[model samples]
Structure formats: C-alpha cells, structure tokens
Target: MELHILIKGERDISGQIYTQIYEAIESGRLVQDQQIPPSRLLAKQLGVARKSVADAYNRLTYDKKIVGYVGRGTFVSGAAAAPTLPHIEAGKAVMGSLKKWGEHADMTPLETAYRCAVDFAGGEPSAHHFYQDEWRSCVLHGLRQCTAKRGKYGETAGVKQLREALIRHAAFSRGVIATPEQMVITNGAQQALDLIGRIVIEPGTCVAMEEPGYPGARLLFTSLGARVVGVRVDSEGIDVDAIPEQAKLIYVTPAHQFPLGMPMSEARRQALLEKANRIGAIIIEDDYDSEFRYSGQVTNSLQSMDKFGVVVFVGTMSKVMFPEMRIGYLIAPPAIAKAAVMVKRLTDWHSNTMVQYALAKFIADGNLLRHVRRVQTIYAQRREKIQAVFGTALAQWFELLPTNAGFHMVALAKRDINIGELIARARADNIGLYSLRDFYYEAAPPAGLFLGYGSVDANAIEPALIEVRNILRAMLWQQKT
Candidate 1:
C-alpha cells in the first residue's frame, strides 16, 4: 500500500521518511500486518535515491516495527499497538459527562456472548402476529393517500386520521377516553416519555419510578436530570406508601409491571392517585402491551379512572407489531396536553408521516385488532406450555409469580441460587435467559427469571424449557455435591 510520506528537503531524507512512517504506525494510520510500498516504489514517488528509502526501511526493520520477506516484501510485523494520546483538559470534562450518560443507558434483551437458538429475551414480539399481507396493503394505501401533500411536515400531534383512529382503538380496547387533540404520536413510547420528561422535569426534579422497573424509563428520566427515587414493588405493584410525597412525576406500569410481572391492585391504584392528588404530582402511566391477557379481570387504563386529570397515558404498537416499527402515542392529562404537544413539536417536529398514516389505516380497517386477536391465541398457548413446564418439570426450583398478562412472566427461584451463573449456563446450552437484575435502580433486585415467550413457537416451548430444566437440575446437583 502507498504510504503518504513528504520528502521536503534532500538533507536527512531517510530520517524524515522513518519518522513519518513511525508516526503513522503510532497513530494507527498504518495498522499491524499492513503492507507498505516497496523501497524502490517509495523512492521513485518521493523523488529520492533508492538507498535513502532502503535506509529508512532498514531502520524500521531494525526497530522490529516492520519486516520484509523475500517475495512478500515489507509488512508491519511489530508496532506498539494503538497508542493513546493524552486527553485535553476540556475533553476530560466532556468524556466525564459521556461516562455519566453511559451509566444511565438502557439495558434490555442483553447481548449474550453466544447466540442462543431459543431466546427468551424480553421486549420481542412474535413474527406470527405481524400482519404482513394486510400491512403491505395498508402501507401502499398510505403511500397513495398520505403523500398528496408530500412537501408538508406532519402535525406534531400526529396525523388527524391516526389521532382519531387511536382514540377509538384506546377507548374500545383499554377504556381510555381521550379527544383527538390530546393525542401526541411519538417515535415510540420511549420518545413520548422523553417529551413528558422535557416539559415537567428540571434539574433535580423529584421523579419516582418503580424499582425493578423498566430500565429504559429509569435511564431516560435520569438522563433528563431528574432526581429519580425508587419505590419498592410487591405483589400489588409499586408500593404507593413508599413513594416520596415530593416526587413531581410518578412513572408506573400499573397494568403489568416490567421484569417482575404483577398488576397493581385496584386499592393500590386508588391509593396512588390520592397520593398524587394530595402532593399535586403527575403520573405517567405506561400501558405498554396489555392487550394479550390470558386470564384476569379486564383492567381498564388509569386514564379511564383519572378524575384529577393527573395521569399521562403512554401506549406503543412495538409489542403488538414488531419492535422495529418505532411508533407510540401519549394522551396527556388535560392540563399538560398542549404543553406535551409543544414539547413533542420541538423534540422531533413529529414522527414519520407515511408511517403514522399507514398505522392509522391499519387500525381503522380493523387489521390491528384482528392481528392482535390471532396472535393472542397463539401467545396464550405458548404461555400455557411455559406455565405447565415450570409447574411440573421446574416446580421444585421456581415459584411462578402471580401474573395474568403480557408477553412475559416472572418466576422467582425457590431458594438462594446464583442467578448470574444460572443465566450463563442456560446461554451455554443455547437458551437465552434473563433475570430481573439490571432493572433495579436500588441495590437489591429480586432473584427471578423474566421468561418471555413472544418469539418462541408453541411446540418449541416444551422442548426448550425441558432443556432448561435439565440444565438447572444439573446445576443444582453440582451445588449439592
């Protein structure tokens, strides 16, 4: 490869060449095992004597930075691996801030060292549910209808068609009552939270989040400079008594808790609302993927029960559709509805125009609900298989938590077991597993497995879980030994 070397003056041309090449190696411009140009070629390019180029090559060889084989020519044999230059004082401060941001980054569906054949990672939706043919038609319809005004940016509050459709969908399905004007479509539920945080949170604003909650929401608020307080979650969901009265914003997954799957008891929900009203706090109710409940009293969204107009309801299609379809919406409490819409406008100036329209049509034409119903049956079956296996094959080891809804469920280990080691061993046997370790903002997270069956097929469920049981048994036996 041609190395860029400038031969300025004829004096000490070889020295200049050697120094430049050395610097190149040091800077990683020339990496290890990279071939350099022949001395003769370099000499001709540099308009210098071949001997001068050869002398430089000889010096590099002597330093063991490069070596030449008879036919292979010169290659970078040895060089001090990539050298780190001293950071500037200004850069140090920026890097320190970056490190702080890194600490608050989202941790979910963790990347395992090995690719597991049967992955039980949370946040994945089943492809069996994806309305490929129906969605294709909807998208084509959207492209035709939505692009009529192709030059215009979509409304920050989402397209009119979507807002209207979502209003109907939410009311019928989740019992959420909202006007089209209050709906602010976002990139995803994640963005909706960010927008809410932007309007309500200032530096050191007191925000309460469910401990062992969705790490994504916790980190998002943390990044926004909110003083996030972790409230303990038990069988009834976030312990309302545990939340500080001063917490300005309270984020809760009331329908189904994240990582640890437990719906908030109605009494607890009422108590939480009273607390919020007493303290004048806004509640962010993330009703993510509550559509696939197997068996339980059909719980209406917190928005339906909101009398004080204090709850900002968030919903996403990612769990119902594929996760890559980054679309979600938020129904702001009447007081902050305009403010949330304004913040959304400033944040990204609205989401994908065509996508919003396509989703609107998908919902309006009943494709979305039909898709959900079909998949709901399949998912229920998968959930049943996992429950049966854990009940029969895995009962001795795991106590299945009380959960009746969502793509995943929680099962606490029967005794003190190394949850981390259990995960590693399961992964080794080609089953990706997760515990509720990373979600905790507090030090002590409960010992349990968050078994998600969304992507796993019904027939594959028993075999995969059987293998998991086998591995767990071996681990337990080894421990006894």
Candidate 2:
C-alpha cells in the first residue's frame, strides 16, 4: 500500500515522518486497522534510511497511534482520533472575510425550557390539543400509499392531492385563489423565504421589512448579501411610504404582524400592492396565525387583492397544526413558480411525501378545519383571561397592545425598566418570558414582552401573570430606591 509520508533533509526526519502519519490517522485519512506501507517500502519511496523509517514507526507504536503484529505490518489503532474542541475558534483573526450578515445568522433551534411552570415563548402551538389518534391513522394510510409506489420520487411542487387540498382550503378560508401548479411545498416558511431570496436577491439588493420584523427572514436576506431596510410599522401595519423604492423584495406579516398583532388595514393593503407594482418589487405575505380571530371582521389576504401578480402568498401549518410537521406552501405567479420548483428540486427534491400525503388527508377529511375551530375557542378563552388579568392587575407596568387576532400579543413597558433583567428574574419564579429586543434589526425596540397563549394552559395564565406582576413591582421598587 502507498503511504503519503514525507521525509525532510536529514534533521528530524524521523520526527517529521511520525508527525505526518499521526496527523493522517487523527484526520481519518488512515482508518482503523488500515495497514501502513512496510517500513522498507516507505524508506525506498522517500529515499530515506530504513532505520529512520523504523524509528518513526517505533515512536508511533509507543504512542499507541499504530499497532503491529509479529507477522503483519503496522496498522492505525482505534485510539488514534481527532481532538474534541470548540468547533469555531473564538477570535476575530480566525474569521477572516466572513460576511457581516453571516456573523448575525443564528441557526440554533428555539429551545423550550423544561423548568418553567408557565412558558410565554412565541410560535409554539398547544401539543395537548393535537388530534394524535386521527393524525396517526392518516399517517398510516399515507405510509401504505407511499409503500405502494416505492422507489419513485414525488413531485417537487408537492403531492397532487395535498396541493389541491391546500388550494381549496386557502380559497375557502383566506380568499387566496391559486391553482395547484402555482404552489410549491417547502420544509417551512423559512425555506420558502430562502427560496425567494435565492431567486430574487443579489449582492447589495435592497430588501424591505418591518422594523421589529421576523428575524428569520431578515437573517436569510442579509446572509444572501441583500441590504435589508427596516420600515416602521404602526397600528395600521407596515407604512407603505417608508419602504425603500429600490428594494427588490418586501417581507410583511400582513394578516397578523408578528410580536405586535395588527392586521393590515384594507386601504393600507391596497396601497402596499400599488407601491409594489409601481416599484416592481415582490411582496412576500406571510399569513401566519390568521385562523384564530376572536372578534372583528376577517380581511381578505393581500394575494386575493393582487391584480398585477406582485404578491407571493406564503402560509404555514406549523402554528395551526404543530411546528414539527414542517409543512408550508408558496403561491407565486407561473413564471416564478416554475423557477421556484426547479430550486426546490435542487434544495431537497421536495418535502417529505409521507407527511404531505398525511396532511392532505387531514385537511381533506375536514379534520384540520375541525381542529382549528376547536382550538380557536380554547385560545379565545385564554386571550380573554389574559386581557382581564392584565387590565385589572398588571396594567400598571405593561400597556397591552391593541390586537384582535393571533395567539400572541406584546405588552410594552410603561416605565423605564430593563427587560433582560426582568426576564432573568421571572425565570427564577418559574415563568418563561422573551424580550422584544430579540426581533429588532435596526431601530432601538421599545422594552416589552411577547406573551403567547398558544403553549400555556388556560388555567395557569392568571397565576403566571400574578407572578409576573409581582416581579415587575419589585423591580420597579428597586429602580426607584
């Protein structure tokens, strides 16, 4: 067998040979029990003295990095392995030429705290409410169907049945009119955003988003070398005039603006569409959590209002169903949809066929609609309970934002207080809270907490708020003293 050991000009020849061989073993280039070249052959190849090769082999043997049998040649040992160290060096010098946006991209999955009695972390759905038995039956049926068509790849756009189901569901519920061919199924809304960014954003391209917007979309665009512009959002929703004219893409949570839950007014939505048309920009409408409106009239999606094909509608089942299901769809124009399908094929060759088939059945059999209707009632009660408690007890510290939709709401701090300190203190009291600062990309966000009712039990909310109120009172007292 050929070995890749190098022998230097005489001085430290044995040491050099030993170092190279040891490195090769550690890096897995030389695997366990793989025989090394005979010392005589290695010496002849390197034009070095046989004794020097023998010496290097002896040193490696002493370190247990290699082993030899009486009849057989030397082999790499199981003990020879790479050192377990921090993946990235913690210094600026090592991160040369790393893009600024890449530095800000946090790919870590959101973790749920096991120790907290009440968790207000946003974007999580109630696991207890999921119809496990029905869902399992659907999964089994999907598995059987998938097994029947073994060895064949499903469509990149999605399973035909699922797309048709989504089209019907979207049209009936959200007023979004799109055929199955215009939709592309993705892993989640994140991947949909990534695909849009891939096709649209070039280096130095302008991407406009709300100031306190979805950090995931911002990070995705920024990482793709787009100059992300933060637009101010008011109670009416994203200010249409505030968006940069040069922006190629605009990301908006129009149905329910994230953190601050306010659906875009119809007039504002029309103005946004006009602005996008005039500027030739693509609007990504992330209509998340529009299913659970406790009160007020439902507004048609911006996609339904589009006449010029500028709005690309993106929706997710994660918030309505469960996060782990990882199902989302994008409705775009035929041209963009074709390109996106090609990109989707390149990305992962389509999302999980089995899960897609299961979700299709779940929606078609009206289980999804039934689930949403049931959960909406429960979430409505929880929302009222939170508002009642806050209006009476916790209103002194927090000014609750006006919202009629979505599972979460923001409580802006009434006084000058450190939200981080408050979060830390609340955790000690077994309450989980998140800071609004986490969502902001440019502007200095107001101090606040995102109180989500999706994951917390309806019974535990009032007591949790009481604990939160106590913490805020004590903190305010400390600040005054």
Candidate 3:
C-alpha cells in the first residue's frame, strides 16, 4: 500500500500521522469504514516504533474518530456518516454499522440523553481524587523501585502485595473477610463482572437481576447469553421474594443500588443470602459506591454476612478513586478463584503492573483512606446542594428521594409528564441528566429522573436547576400545543 503520510512540522512522528489521518477524514480523503494500514506496517513505513502507532490509534479511539475492531483491524468509523435523530430513541435502535459487542448496547434514548454545560453523569467520582502531587509521588516511588527490576507477572490471580492490601482494606472498610489468595485484581468491576460471567454463566442460563438496576451488569449478563429476569426492587432494596429460585446467578448492588441510590436493608440482605444458599445459586454482589455513605454506620457488605460462600464480592476503586485507575477485584470462593485466575490470564494477562504497584503503595501509605474521607466530605456537600436546588426548582412537579448516602438521587417527575420529552428539553439546555425509566426492563415501572450530583459543584447547581426547570416548563408547553 502506498503510504499517504502527511508530515506537518515538528510535532513528533506519531502526532504527524494522527493529524494527517484526522485531516484526511475531515476532508473526505478517507471514506467511512476505509481500512487503515496495520500499526506495525504504518510504523515501519514511518520509521518509528509500533508503540507510537498504537498510541495514535488509542487516542483516536478515545475521541470516537476511528474504529478498531479486534482481529478485523482498524478503519474509519462508519458512525461518522450516520444520520442524527432529533430525539433519543425510547428503546435500543441501530445507531451505526459497528457490530454491537459488549455492554454499550441496549442503552435507550433516555439512558443516553442529557447534555450539560456542566455534566453530573452517574458512576463518576470527582477529579480531586486524582491529586497530581499524590499520583506523582506514588509514581516516582514506584519507578524508583522498578529501576532495580521490572516486576514479572507474579501470579495469575494478582500481585500478592496488592491483594494483601485490598484484603485488609475490605475487612476494615467493607466488613468482608477475605484473604489475599481469595482475591483477583481486575480491570475495574466491569471486567470482574465479565470474568465471572465467563466462568459461571453458560449460554442461555437464567440470571436474576434487580429491576431499576445497573445497566452495565444487565448488558454484561445479556451479552453472555444469560436469560436475565428482572426482580423488582422496593424501598429497602431488591425484593428477595421476587427473585426465582431457579436463577443460576443473582446480581445485586446491595451496598447501594445504582441509579436508584437505595441501600439494601439488613433484613433483605440476610433473606437474599439465605435464599441464594438454599438454591445453591451464586450471588454476585457489586459493592459499587459503598465508600461514600453519608448516613448512619455504613451497612455491612452482603459478602460479610454470607457463610455459604455463594456470594462473589465485586469491589472497584472506580467510584471512590478514579476510573482510569482501572483496578477492581473479586473476592471469590476458593473453588471459583482458581478458575477465575485461568479465565483472567487468557483475557488480559493481568492489569497494568505500574498502576497496580502504585495502588499498592497508595493503600499501604494510608493515602487512599485519607483521600476517600476528603472526597466523601465534598460529595456529601454537593449532594445537599443539588437536593436544595431540586427542591426549589422541581418541587411542584417532582418528588426527590432521600439519598442519605452516595453521589446520586432519584426524582419522580409528575405522572402526567413525559419523562423522555422532559429529558430532551434538558439536553437542549446542555445538561446531561439521566431518566430512571431507562433503568427498568418492563415497559414502565416508575417514571423518574436519575440525577448525579458529585460530578458538578455548588457553583453549578442553581444554574443547572434553572435550565432543568426551563426544560420541564417548555416540555409542558409543547404538550399543550
């Protein structure tokens, strides 16, 4: 293939290639889905290392400017030419030509809608947790230690030091009694879910999941060919009575349910554990956002109460620390941990070692605990600020639920109002909130909006509420017309 490399000044070899490709796409020189040369081939042509080309491809992928299908190779994303819809879809629709693979599929219009001048999207912690000085200190120390020797892949399970650190943290903070050998580090809880799904969920197996639950879990179970049955959730948490005994796996966010922000009551947790053991089914407990409880003494983790070893505890730093950290782990039974190690080794060959080392030191030095405490204070204040704003702006048409803990809350829009249309209006004003209707499997359960407050600050809350009120008010006018 003839190299169409466009060198632009002295911005480094990789930068030149990246800019040329981007410009080519914008200028119509590269058509949609056009195949690109292999990274190795491109690197050889440009007289640079393949790593440089890989880095360029990674940047493009993050920007959604290119598509890289595993095994099939990289191409100009066909989504570049896809037509836009005025409103988001009520259900999943084909958005582009990309073969839907993983959890990004099945997201509805309301699930994805909401744009914001200041985004308060769910499942994110504040950037303050990624303290540059703290990260740099840890990175420098890790580099100094690695200077003597690059740590070889220690165990298929994970690095021992990190596992030991996590075991202590879980015992003290989460009430889960786990040993280092019982834990396996993952690329965040998403991958933990994927690994467990791979090992336990055979094609077409029945899995019980809470209704109005985490879509990420729902998508993973569905993609793995699990027959996902939605068990309705109530004030306390997932209705233990509603879940079927035949389910092979029961997934729950008992620490704090996603989107809904309700914690599983102790009674419900005990019932679920008893029921799960009776049926000999595996319980996957996703302890998401458990670190930021603002209420009374934090609830004990479901895994802590389990004597049957049926609960597979999934823990991640994504909510408490930063998502880029990509360090989550699963505390599995001795039987499952070995199988999980084999599956994980085949998947990604363990997580990034440098980050793992840094995380180990971070926890050992007690900085992670301190950081979480600092962040919890900030999130609690922001949660209150958002509640006050919601009260003033949405009082007449909405009832805000009390989320004493966690970074998000739920608001039930008036029964007469269309939740989807209201969200679209909010998007027009540049606010990307989410709707609770998208959280359920049924046609309708409860009509409400899921508001994430941690990502935004006190300064941005009132103005955001103004925009939200305006959007809802305009939505009413449109309905009247």
Candidate 4:
C-alpha cells in the first residue's frame, strides 16, 4: 500500500508528516505496533531531506507517539491511544420532534427480565428454549451465501428467499396469505411501524392506538408527528366504535394484546375491518408473541380477514426467538408497499441481509415451527402454574384476565394499592415487576401487572407469587392502620 504525503506550497513538509501521524494515532486510525515507512524511504517518497524526516521522527519518539526498534521500522507506541470524546449538549436549533419524543418517551424496560431472579416483565423469550445448534447451522449457510455476493447492493424490499419463506410461515402459522411482492422485511416490527408511518403520517395526522397498547409503537408515531388518540380496549380487543373517524392510521395487537393478553373476538375483528374500510384509514396489525398459544382456536390474522386492502400485518422473531435476533416482516397493500419500499430505501437502503437469510433458512428448514412447538409446551406449563396460583391465593388482591394465548397474562388489581411502592419493594426483593401504567397515554390505565412466563422457570412461578402475596398482605395491613 502506498502512503502519500502532500507537500503543499513549500511549507514545513516534516511538520506536516508529524502532525498527520499524531492525529491518526489519536483518532484510532493507527494502532499500537503498526509499522511506519523507513526514514529515508519516507523522505524520498515526499521529496524532503532525510534530516527533516529524522528530526520529525525524533520529536515523535520524545512525545511517546512512536517508538523505533534497532533493526525494525518505527511503530506506534503502546501508550498511544485515542482520547475519549466529550459529550455535547443539543443546540437550541434541534428539531422540535426530537423534544416531543423525549417528553413522551419512557425507555421501556424491555430486557430487564434477565437481571432479576423472578421476572414478570413481558415480551422476552427463554434462552433455554432457543434452538442454538439449528440456528447456528442456518447462520453458517447464510455466511457462505453472503460471501459470494459481497460487493453487490441488495433490494430494499429484502432478499427474495426470505420474503418467500415469510410468506409460507405466515400462511400456515397465522393463517395470513401474501405473496413475495407484498412483504418487506425490516430490522424489527418497530422499524416496520416506522416505515409505514413515513408512508402515511404527516403533521397533525390522526392516529388511533389501543390505550395501554405497546408504548414503543406510541412513541414511534408520536415522533413522526401523528396526533395519536388512545382508543378504549375491553374484554374484546380494541373498541371499534371508540376509534375517531378522523384517524388515518389504526394500530392494534389483536392476537393477544400487549401488556393485556386478550385475543380479539371474531365479531370485533370484522367490526374493526369494516370501520377501517369505511374511514379510509390504514390498520397496522402487530401480531407479536401470539404464536406461542396454549389453547383456544388459533386466531386468523386481520390481514387474512380483510376484504379491503387496509391492514398491514406485522410480525417479529424477537418475541419467538431471543430479543436480539431482530428480524420482522410486514405484509402491506400494493400502494402502501410501493411507498413503504421507497421509504425503507431512503431510510436505510435495506436491513442486514445476512441475518435475513439466516432467518429465512430457519423458517424454511422447519426449525422455526419445531422451536415454537417445543417452547409452547414449556410456556403452557408456566402459564398453568400462574393460572392455578392466581385462582387459589392471588384471588384476594387481583382478578386474572382470562387469556389462553401468548407468554403473558394481566391481573387487574381488585383494589387500589400503592403500585409504585409495590414495584420498588419487589425490586428490593430481587424480583422484577412492571406496572401497566406506562402503556396508557391520555388517562390513567387500570391498575394491573403483566405476568410474563417467558423468562421465569416454571418451578419458580409459585414461590415468586407466594413472596408477592406476602408483600401485598403487609401493604394491606399498613394501609388499614
């Protein structure tokens, strides 16, 4: 490799070399033990005198930026390292949308499950349930395939194989039908929502989301400048009538609602679809974590039921696989997909292609189905344990919301207790508990706790709940006095 040094306007050539080398070392571009050109060779290369180069080298050595061996060339000193960058505060001219996002954001504690002994925070999967060997094999396959296509840019729509694989998986698993052209793979369901938002949302655009719905989704739309209104959710999913007529976008978690696990009834699904068709609005169906159902009829995806091209079906491997996997797909209507594809291209020009191929192979080889079936039984056992305990001992303080699908179940508090205090106390006891309050926007959501059985072992469920029962008892005793 040639190292070119410019000698401009007969200025100090040696000084220029010294400054460039020092800056490179300080910026981490040059690392320790890296060799520099011979003094004579460098001087000849720059058309400068050997004495000038030697003088610069001597100065650098005294400063400990470079060290020279007797026989070998000069190398960057071990002491030479990049300095830490200082944090800069945002300027006054920063975007107003960024300020709004900060005001509305809570930084939802998503991966807190692994940090505590007993965790009830939802939307995580068990490490023990992940098919490591199978996934590793698929990753190897993806790497081999990726090596052959190194210099090329891929389609923003995504790798063709992965799109086809997602289409097949969605058809059988969720009863949703789509072609390769209709689907666009994303970094996660979160990004899919963002792309869809980019396509439709404008300043003051009306967006309807389920109250106490996914907080992450709420923040995304809010940052996109949507006037998000919270629609009431009941025993039957999101209330169709409560949705404002002006709302151009509707987001729902129908197959096991987030934080509150309740599959939308068939009648309610029809009503929602009819309402969306009537209002000329687009619906985003985030069918996350509903694949691990224990009992009841497997609900068809809203996209499957849509006679009108309104529903944009979104699904993620994060909940089914580990949270770090970060692969999701969205099946949208033709016009929306065309717009979403263009938006996705402008945003990032496509997601990571290698991981997409790995997931595609995972789904194609039947590993994904096997993995889900394998974990479904384990989750069902944990769910049953929570169900049995909530009936026998937990009935005094909370009412278990009837749910048969997903890794989490919500329990509405029977009476008002200091939830903030309860959470802090639980954390002190080495248990991770989360409240549903953060999910609500306009009004205070009903007091409840989302009991996720994903990370907690089945055997530990009762013991943890027993400890919670004791804490509640102590709290009630104090409140009465």
How does model 2 fare in lDDT? 0.88
- Best-fitting candidate, scored by TM-score: 4
Please, what's the RMSD in Å of model 4?
A: 3.7
The C-alpha lDDT values of all candidates are 0.86, 0.88, 0.81, 0.86
Return the lDDT, model 3, position 462. Answer: 81
Tell me which residue pairs clash in candidate 1.
Answer: none
Residue-wise C-alpha lDDT for candidate 4, range 249-366, written one tens digit per residue: 9999999887678889999999999999999999999998888877788888999999999999998988888868778889998888889899999999998888988988998999
Runs in model 4 with CA error above 4 Å? 1-89, 95-98, 106-114
Taking the tens digit of each residue's C-alpha lDDT, what string does model 3 give over 1-481? 7559855555576777777777677666777888898899988887778987888888777777788888998888733354333575544455442345523554633344433677767776787555668777888876766666565664667777789999998998898987898999999999999999998898889899988777778888888889899988888999999888789899998877866777889999999999999987899999877878788768889888988989899999888888888999999899888889999999988887667778888889898898889988888888877778767877888888766677888888765777777767667667776778767875375778887776786688788888778877777788889
Q: lDDT of model 2 at residue 179?
A: 96
TM-score for every candidate vs. truth?
A: 0.81, 0.81, 0.78, 0.87
> Residue 324's C-alpha lDDT in candidate 1?
78
Residues 1-481, model 2: lDDT tens digits = 4688766577988889989988887777788888998889999999988898899999999999899888987888854454444476557864654645356645322465374788887888888988899999999989988998889999999999999999998898899989999999999888899999999999999999998898888888988889999999998999999999998999999889986998889999999999999999999999878988887889989999999999899989989999899999999999999989998899899899999989999998899999999999889999899899889898878888988888999999887878999899989888988888878878998999888889899999999999888888898788789
Q: Which ten residues in a row have the lowest lDDT in candidate 2?
A: 101-110
How would you order the candidates by lDDT, starting with the best?
A: 2, 4, 1, 3
> Candidate 3 versus the native: TM-score?
0.78
| Candidate 3 ranges with C-alpha deviation above 4 Å | 1-115, 477-481
